[model samples]
Target: MKAEKNAVLTGAHFIDGDHAACEGAIAAGCKFVAGYPITPSTEVIERIALRFPLVGGVFIQMEDEIASSIAIQGAVWAGKKAMTVTSGPGFSLMMEHIGYAAITETPCVFINVQRSGPSTGLPTLPAQADMMQARWGSHGDYEVIAIVPNSPQECFDLTIRAFNLAEEYRVPVLVMMDECVGHMTEKVVIPEADQIDIVERKFTKKPPGEYKMFETNESMVPEMIKVGDGYRMHLTGLTHDERGYPAMSPKVQQKMLRRLVDKILLNEEKIRHIEEDEVEGADIVVISYGITSRVVLPAIKKAREDGLKVGHIRLLTVWPFPEAYIRDLAKRVSAFVVPELNLGQIVHEVERCAAGHAVTRLVPHAGGAVHEPVDIYDAIKGVLEHA
Candidate 1:
């Protein structure tokens, strides 16, 4: 019997990483982009600003990150797919609005071309250091969808997915890319415009007299009505009821809050995405994502060559954390090795999911550059031998 081809074929493209991300967003039907230029991420905005006008799109270089994020939300509320590109410091400034978007259920895309952190640790250097921050940086208990692309092609592909997911869920989506993938050149084949699947937000169909902005349904995502759509809707950062009016009651607030979190949490199966390898009979599993996962690939291969039963789990969806998959892997693996460009962010999640079934270890590295494959190989070998 002949082998069947996988439905999702993985391939790489040779193109400037930032340009690829920009081109991908354009191809994905993004009509509005608002951002403040920051290092590493500047290329993304630069390309978007140059090309947006050609595509009948609006690209604004706002006064600052806060205004940029606000403009993005405004564009989405106007019924257009909008995005903002930024880095660490700019992302810090956008946190409040990120929370606002969460509460308002405004669907927009945020591209964070990550650079060294704390406070501009290394602008040109790559870092997976923002993983935790991407998930928790914004205040509050809302769930946000963040996609980490390991390459330029993924930067493009996932940017499209981010927009699609944003519209489908009516929540803000993030394209989390690091300096290496953002700057590296790779060959990418972009599909024809008609070949791509575009998802638009579910607009309200009820008459103006019957519309309720925050009303929930089976999906928990309310039907959105744009400003001029003849529906009188009120949007607020404060906890609100179905009428979109501010609610002071504790029960209303709790119900609203739970719905906000539940919408994403309960739909984990649809939102969670991951890549797993060699786990049928593995004793060691290396968990990684983004550019850091690129380093992990070779290390896993070397460990296998050295006669160790090893495997890997790469997360394409960074936020919402793919806990179920991790927990399942934890049950079968002897140890979970997590490598990232930070002291210990994702490792905490891995440890939490692994529980007592497997030992979880962190191979931490800070910004200047990525962890060498040899270091990861050593960690994998050490864990396997030690275990």
Candidate 2:
């Protein structure tokens, strides 16, 4: 579908990642934003507050992050694409609502401009530490699609994709941004409206009496029905049946829970994304994402120059784990080097997929900043030497 004309900012502009993301949201037809501005992420809503109204959108800065988190769901149920922006401290506050969105199948987006620390470590610094939290921050068995952008251009491009995926799967999608990417300025070219492809919510064609809210077809994503559309609906966080009513039997729990996960895993082919280079015969494959991917580029070039056959896999979508690709690649590579802003989050995932078939080494950091190219270079060098 083409973008809504009023919402499309079809032009080139030099801007920061936060502002680029805001424009992407506008272009993707996201008309409502509810957020409590935190450092690094405040600029996203700052731009939205100014642009949303012009595009017939709504911008609400709620009293706190919890209010901001749940507010977007309300807008989504009312037939609007909605989102909330936040940082570490605020993201923790929003966990309960994230779970609520999952069980109730609310299609919404959340932008997390990650900062460093367990509790307010560095408001102005950068870190990719929230990766694990983004995957498992909410308690329960569910899946989320997360994408990381290394530049302002992708920041603009992928924010639109995030909303599309949310609507496609009826789950909360996360734009896992870092403070560096959020603040870094670069040229972002947004294309004309006709060039943009969008996926709108699939509203049910069934009449009021026939529309069962949680019923699904082949895609496992149930067609949604608006609350005031004269449809009889009941949505709950507890185990629910096809009619959306509370059902507590073990059989009901297994059916509902499995569908929630299987929808993503079984359909993983549609969602698998990774930028791989020279992995055909390379011994060491470096896996990284977000700001860390950017930093690792220089090191990759250096490795190539030294005649070390090093390949690169840059993760665009971090969730659902990209299990198939990693599992296959692990068999051929001598070792997999995993690095991130956290001490060791995604590395465990790499190890799990590799499953003792190959060596998986970690390059750890405690956040507040990114790694130096040399630090990553040395890690890659050591692994290849042992190989």
Candidate 3:
């Protein structure tokens, strides 16, 4: 795609939040989008369908979420930057394919613009209820990356980062966007082409007969060869060896699965991302992410003004869950308070990290509306005065 002359200002003109995310995906070199229409996330597909044809990219509206996810995997195998966007219900339908992406080590992005749910609790309301689901939704013990963006700019920036991480790790990366960020518009500065850092899938320059599909060198990211590249590569959802052939033998399966998990799990330093504020001297640390972090910020400010030793930690990458950072903060702070749209998804992680050093509290609010700043402020005040 040729760079538009005034493309730097393109995001500025996209007033609709979803359209901004759609334009961001295109600007970030996404060539294929396959998804079913769902509330909140539907606009992403609609926008892509309209613009992709002009850029020589492909856009397919599948009959269902299952087919949409399957099509995305196929597009990725065809060596394009491909993605599927969905809400809670659609995401439920795509779980099996998500596991398929995991086992095949397919590099692709899945955008879940989350709406309320255990099972379609609220189709159009914002909720961070999917936090745990994003990590454990697919089934099995596979490690994956899930990022939460709090605003439209982050929805744009993190979507691009999600693609980069997927290609680098050869794993499915999920961008968790709540209805709040996915539907709200704000000024987003899209970087110029020369200023942007884009990572393409690493491809082998070796001749067709010489290439190995899953052979890993020092980087642990194997050189990807496309399906029709005359490489004779094989891919399957079953456990497979370096050649991409199914390895039914117990030992081969063990080796392949271990490597797949280790490739991301062992590289914790590279995958973990968070933002810390006033944490150094704090006695109570408030932990939050996604849209909940937006609400928590004002509470943190209020606590500070009230002369409470309160601080905040906002996670940029929610999965591969910033355990190390949380653990470190745990040793220093007197207590930890986690506020989310769900009852206790992330609070458990904070509790695990805090262990014996600090007390952990859950300030949860479900689907109907966001937790007000005062609710979080009271939680922090209570934890501090009582701990």
Candidate 4:
């Protein structure tokens, strides 16, 4: 599907990543937004509140993060594309609903502009600490698609991608933007509506009497029906049968939960997006995402100038973790150096994927600031010197 004409801005604009993300959501046919303002992420909904009205959409500031999270799911079931924006604390509050969205197969976007913290740590600063939480915070054995943006332009581009993935997979999609990317201002060119591709919600054509909400085809993704559209739909976080009713049995639990996990795991190749540079023949690969990807570029450059073959891999979609690619690359590379704003999260995934074939080095940072290029360069050199 193509984007709506009126919803596409269709021009060049210099804007912050948060505002760019809002424009992307609108361009992607997101008609409803429910969120409470949170630092470094508030501008997304602030722009939505003003722009949604012009495009015949709705934006509501719910009482809190929990309300905001669940409200978008209601809008989604009512046949509207929906999203919510928040930072760390608010993101934590939304975990239960995230799991609900997973179990019920709700297609929605969550824009989490990550801040420093376990709890309200650094409201205005940047951190990539939520990398692990975005995938595993909700609990249980469900899967989600997570995309990270390193700049304002990518913030605009990937926000639209997030909604499309949500619609395509019938799972919650997270746009993991750190405070640096969320607030960074740059030129973003939004093409005409026709120039963009969109994935509309997959609604069932079966008659009301014949329809079952959780019935699936070969793809393992179930078709949806709009609420109040003459079709009966039942949705819950509990283990459900094909008809969407709680079955409360171990058999039903295995069947339903496994599908939720397998649909993503089975189709991992289709969902994974990683950018690799100079990795074909290199001794060390520096892996990073979001803001940290940009920060580590100079270090990678210096390592190369110093004659150490340092490859670079930027994870565009962090979740579903590109394990196969990393596993394959590990066989050729001697070590993988991972740097993050958090202490160490994604590096663990790298270690697992490397699987004893290669060494995994972490350049960890606490929340408040980004890593120095020297720190990353030293890690790269140290890895190579040891090898």
Quote each prediction's TM-score. 0.95, 0.98, 0.96, 0.99
Clashing pairs in 1: 13-186, 13-187, 13-188, 14-186, 14-187, 14-188, 15-186, 15-187
Output the lDDT of residue 227, model 4.
88
The alpha-carbon deviation from the true structure for residue 143 of candidate 2, after best TM-score superposition, in angstroms, is 1.0
lDDT of 1 by residue, 273-315 (tens): 8888887788888888989989898898888999999988888
Worst 10 residues of 4 by lDDT: 230-239
Candidate 3 clashes between residue pairs 3 or more apart in a chain or in different chains: none
The numbered model that scores best in lDDT is: 4
What digit string (tens of lDDT, one per residue) describes model 4 on residues 126-191?
999999999899888789999999998899899999999999999999999989999889999999
Clashing pairs in 2: none
**How would the candidate models be sorted by lDDT, starting from the highest?**
4, 2, 1, 3
C-alpha lDDT score of every prediction, in listed order: 0.85, 0.90, 0.84, 0.93
Each candidate: RMSD: 4.5, 1.0, 1.9, 0.8
| Runs off by more than 4 Å, candidate 4 | none
Off by over 4 Å in 2: none
